[model samples]
Target: MKKFWLSLLSIIIPASAVTFEDNDTVVLLGNTVIERAQKYGYLETAINLSARKKKLKFRNLGWSGDTVFGHARSYFGPPKEGFDRLKSDLTELKPNVVIVCYGAVAAYDGQKGLPEFLAGYETLLSMIKSSASPREIVIVSPPPAESLGAPMPDMREHNKRLALYSKAVGKLAQKHKLQFADFFTTLGESKGLTDNGLHFTPEGYQTAAPKLVEALGLSLATGNQLQSEHARKLREATVAKNKLFFFRWRPANETYLRLFRKHEQGNNLKELPMFDPLIADAEKQIEALKKTTLSLK
Candidate 1:
């Protein structure tokens, strides 16, 4: 059974592109776009089903409002502290593949901020390479903002800036010889894709998931397959796993748990690692479901 899946993956994944091998751990890192994906699970589901890697592990390390500078991740400390935290998490996870998506919030700064954004992005990539040393890095251009009429505020100008940033991202990917996923261009101004011209709705993620798989040079899973019972089970397991990880990494009342105020609730710190086994168990469930789904097909 394992050999069958391996052979299928080899056939589906283009040799010229980055590939996912069995047991490869993939970490999704970025801003609101990446972070919110965990809630829908469509993107992860598509990747898993399309790649057909039974043991492929996924970790969502997305931080809402995050920048290449790690501002959202900084918590109560300096931006450097947030950046350090990102490095630390990557080092701990030691993923085989890292998919990075940014440029949304940074694009708001427009032309004046372009240079700084690019520089920060370069530094962030270097940090990932030095810290985690992943086998492959995939840079994803931020998805374009939608233009819902009336009360949604026009996003045409913002999308223009986004396109500029996306172009820069593509060039960076080419220069570094890395795989690039251009959501900005692929998902340009779709109706019902975004709720407020920015964040994706569930249906939007469903629409974008196949595009992501295509951009990564992998075969696309059919809508029927994605909606199947086994697939739904897999997605549920994926979401459950992501929630466990989120709590493990970003616990409630962190200032009291493991920071300066740790003296008060630090005793609970030992409970953090307990989620590791739970996450592993959830992955096992996902693996089993993948096999069951494939066998049915």
Candidate 2:
């Protein structure tokens, strides 16, 4: 019985002792996109890269259906845990970079005009900035939502505000001289980086993590980069074959056709599935390619 208790303690001890290493706490704040990543995903890999240096830890504070600037912590409420932890979380981790993703919720029902939204957003940014003293921050543009399917009239209008809010965030990053991850521009190319219209899948994280990794200056060495370049082309060939399979199967490959259209931004580590099975299949192949490429080093 004593041996059993000691063994259990040994396992639980390390898990409990874990406090997300220093310098790279990588505080990710936003909506479900950030929240879902708590499970195994690319954000894990990105943190791993960041961790390779100064002991990285991922602190998730994503709240679903929150707005970028509507002061959600007050009215809309927060996750059971609350993003307010940013203050204490920062005090403890002193994150090297804070990546924020909170626009989708604010865009939802808030009748506030653009200026009001921006003001609310600015306050949030201020809170985040002040909390950490001098931690680096990255303003990630909220990915577009599938507002077309929502029943609420306001939900219909939310995406526009989210877009505008993203623009304002860009300005804030510039003003603060913080890192701006133009996830809007980079992710804007596809059907806005998601399949369910909102919420990321395994693939969405795959697409965004590398960009965030690069944004944080967590670049792999030149030797690794050179090897990655060669591996990338072989992966491209794999994608081309997947595209061929789609063309060969199903209704003139219309679904596959839509996949390319929706997943045009499929490169750059995107993991979201697209309009067709064929296209989605090709994406999976590409994903495998990325794993193999990254493994070379």
Candidate 3:
């Protein structure tokens, strides 16, 4: 009985210390945008769907209601469960990329603004870059919220700040050479947002997912391995919505997005196998993606 108890302690202690370590993981961090209530960030469903649709392995690490600015309080130090979870994710998961969607939770706090947000966010990126498992970091701006809802004044002002906020996001990404995504701009106005006007509608996700893949440098056709493993988990989960036309791809024609579309529609995989050597080269990468999403509990 004593030995069994000792062995249990040995296992439990290390389990408590476990840190995420898969390199291909795409860690999604944020508040309600990524909570179970909202279905893993409004963008998660589609991105996860994209992972499965393209057969990419993927994992999710988002906590609902976590304001990025507030995460330190909610996630670590005195030890907010979410913060503890995030530390575990960073120490053990070791994802290839960590995409963060935050700010909305703090939008009403009246303290954080574009510059303050940028400075604080830069620190977070610097920490990740300096950490044991340096990763590809992606910054996502908060989506626009309903104008007349809870904390009514704050919500009304939120959309007005989108452009200003997006500029900061762009500048920060430029400074750090990271990818930037504006859920606000992407899902703004014409996208048919929810009644609340902030949370995206099912249609909103369909609109946002492909663009996220483009911004994150995932092959639309091939998929980014950053989100791997859970591809088959929700293959049949479909939500209905209207399709909205989007603005043209600006700046770089972006090979990742372009190549992805081709891969998505291609149907000659069997014939390609005839070029076994080339196929082997391509598959080495696909196999690598599989390893990224394999761990995350």
Candidate 4:
């Protein structure tokens, strides 16, 4: 099994591609596209499998409806507060790599919002640099929106805006000397990738995972390998770990747990750290699963 796995790795991941070091923590920051990734675990699984020999940690800090301003993450506070939370999370996670995924939501405003989007993204990158001081930062362009025919309104015009945003993202990556994952160009218009014209379905994530791995300069896993029982187990373990981390960071009743209304359950804050051990346990499971070989048959 070990020999088989190594042989597969050699073919998929090139020696020149970027690779994670032992104990490296990678944080994913963005909006719905990123947040939804946690549910499927395809991206995380692919990355982990590619670096099976190393112990890597992944933290998904994605929020639905979030922007470069961190608006959706703000909760009851102002957008600035959301930005603060982002900094706080980065500080706490102390990631070695930070992957920033924005621009899709911002592209919604079209030409009218491009400037502000870029400005906000610049600020967001600066904040990540200062707060986390990660060794590497990756900027990911959102995948192109699909046109699912009649009822699902054509997204060609919107995709044009996304293309503009993707180009800007590439420029930013170059300016900052960071890595860029241009999904807009790489993934293109693949039918059935998304349920609607925008959001990815589970299969969509599966399809995009290798593209992400490739964009990051890592080895690409074949669909058959990714669908193997071994891979499924690893992905399931990743999803479990992510769930624990999510509840730890964003408790359902945060208003009572850590906010102004915390007087009622502030003491429960101690329970938050309790999730650390459980998350660690889940990660252990993932690590163990990573060593197992996928059954190509």
Q: State in Å the error of residue 39, model 4.
A: 0.8
True-vs-predicted CA distance for residue 89, candidate 3, Å: 2.0
Prediction RMSDs, each to the true structure = 6.9, 18.7, 20.4, 7.0
- Give stretches of model 3 more than 4 Å off: 1-23, 36-56, 70-85, 109-112, 147-156, 201-203, 214-233, 236-297
Sort the predicted structures by TM-score, highest score first: 1, 4, 3, 2
Instruction: State the C-alpha lDDT per candidate.
Output: 0.86, 0.52, 0.48, 0.84
Over all chains combined, what TM-score does candidate 3 have? 0.55
lDDT of 4: 0.84
Tens-place lDDT digits, model 2, residues 1-297? 999987533321211111233434566677677766654245544544333334343445554555653234332244422346445545665666677765556555344665666676677778777777545666666666553344523233556666676666666666766666555544544443455667666666656666555544454433234225544453344435434432332224333343444365425222223334655465455445445555555
Task: Give candidate 2's whole-model lDDT.
Answer: 0.52
Per-residue lDDT for 1-297 in model 3, tens only? 999987533321211111223324555666655543234233544454334323322334455566554464342135354344465556665666677777775555443555576676766676566552544576777766655446534455656665556555656666766666655555555544454666655555545566565444342334343233343332212111100000111112222333344465445333433444543343344444333334332
Better of 3 and 4 by TM-score: 4
State every prediction's TM-score relative to the real structure.
0.92, 0.54, 0.55, 0.91
Clashing residue pairs for model 4: 13-219
Worst 10 residues of 3 by lDDT: 240-249
Q: How accurate is candidate 1 locally (lDDT)?
A: 0.86
Model 4 lowest lDDT segment of ten: 8-17
**Consecutive 10-residue window with the lowest summed lDDT within model 1:** 8-17
